[model samples]
Target: MKQVCLAILTALLALTVVSPASAQYIWLDKNNVKVYSDKAPPPDIPNNRVLKGPRGYKAKNIEVKYTDGTEPPAPEAKAASAPGTPKPPMTTAEKNAEFNKRRMEQAEKEKKAAQEEKNRQAKAENCERARAYHRALQTGQRISRTNASGGKDYMGDEERARETSKVEETLRECN
Candidate 1:
């Protein structure tokens, strides 16, 4: 008995769910314009204008024939392309390729700009070093160095001239 009662309850719930799917309603608005919906019309609508739609009616591609014998206008067609020269629109893959190409180009430009900035900083540092060396050369301080044999070697006039020329070359190249 309990199994039978459970089966009856399940059947009742299924019917309630399926009944609304097959039901449709039609009504006229305040301006007498025809409206179709799945739900019942509101209380403000007159009983005469409220109608029961066709059984199991799906709304897609369904045309409404007015009571006054007038049919709605047909949908407009798409514009035609020129003969023999028509180009199809770009596909999703083509659009994505174009976007990636632009993105890569932008990344390359940014990398080049960073490299140029680094080069500029290096040049500035070299220029400062050359200027400092030139200033020391002009100071006329006795310049000497310890040789590999631990003997003190003083720079002669010819050695001084060579060193000055090298410093000048560095200044010109960096500046």
Candidate 2:
């Protein structure tokens, strides 16, 4: 029995030591949402920032490897320090034209961003309003159906109409 126990222990130890760990990379998508996976992105995707997995299985142990794909030649000290570039002088008219162009571009970008935000908010609000309307309808139907007594003990037709109108107002606000 002791020999069998020893063999079992040995087998467990071997299993523990035999399996090696692997690493994985993680990054955010276009929507600024985080994603993690074992595979690398394809070449067509811009910014080939590879997240190098550690020698272990856990993602937390992964290291960020910024391999910019392009090969860099050996650097020379003299070429780096040389400030041979000259800035071109701009006339007042040219400067004003450039400023106006940049202002228009910035305004256009802001407008598009605002429109996208508005659309997202409208969608969320519409969903909420629709859900509320559905719930009210369901509740009203349940109240009306279950109370099948000949006497009018539940909400009258006028009250039901008011409730429906309120829900419609909420939906209109979403639009």
Candidate 3:
């Protein structure tokens, strides 16, 4: 029983080491069915259709062996720097500048909200006026408007019809 357990552990360790290097490549065949394999597809397959395999966990130090028996080039090591040097702290002026920028952004947001609310109120008032005019025209009430010369002029039948159409258009737009 001990020997069997040991063998199973060894097999698991072997799989863990080999699985990452054997990440599968996937692509669609001519029939549009997905095909998966460890090796690259045939040269006839378009490069665009080939999907890259999932990335696997890599060890800090992994060695590659070439089948041609040639030694790989050595990697360059980075020089370590001294640890005592630290980043400079922010100045008071810098803090104030950041605070001012945030304040300006908040102010702009408040201004935009106020403007949108004002526009909504104006639209509501205009809609109410249009509805009132439509109701008056339907009731056949006398409709009059001040001309550019400041004289009260009663609307003729054609004028009333045009006004009714205009009010109807306004109502449709507002609603």
Highest TM-score model number: 3
lDDT of 3 by residue, 1-175 (tens): 9999999999999999998776477876655668888776666566655776546522133456899999766532211243433334569999999999999999999999999999999999999988988899988878888999999998888988998999999999997
Q: Please list the residue runs of candidate 3 whose C-alpha ends up more than 4 Å from where it truly belongs after superposition.
A: 1-89, 147-151
Error of 3 at 32 (Å): 52
lDDT agreement of model 2 with the native: 0.63
59-93, model 2: which lDDT tens digit per residue?
22233345997544423553365575224468999
What is the lDDT for 59 in model 1? 35
Alpha carbon lDDT of residue 36, candidate 1? 76
- Report how far residue 152 has shifted in candidate 1, in Å: 5.6
Give per-residue CA lDDT, model 1, range 31-145, as digits (tens): 5567878776666555666666666643333445789887755432221432433355589999999999999999999999999999999999988988987887778877888
* Local lDDT at 31 for model 1: 59
How many times do residue backbones clash in model 3?
Answer: 0
Ranking by lDDT: 3, 1, 2
Q: Which pairs of residues clash in candidate 1, taking residues 3 or more apart in a chain or in different chains?
A: none
| TM-score of candidate 3 against the unseen true structure | 0.46
Model 1: worst 10 consecutive residues (lDDT sum): 75-84
Clashes of each: 0, 0, 0
Model 3, residue 128: displacement in angstroms? 1.0
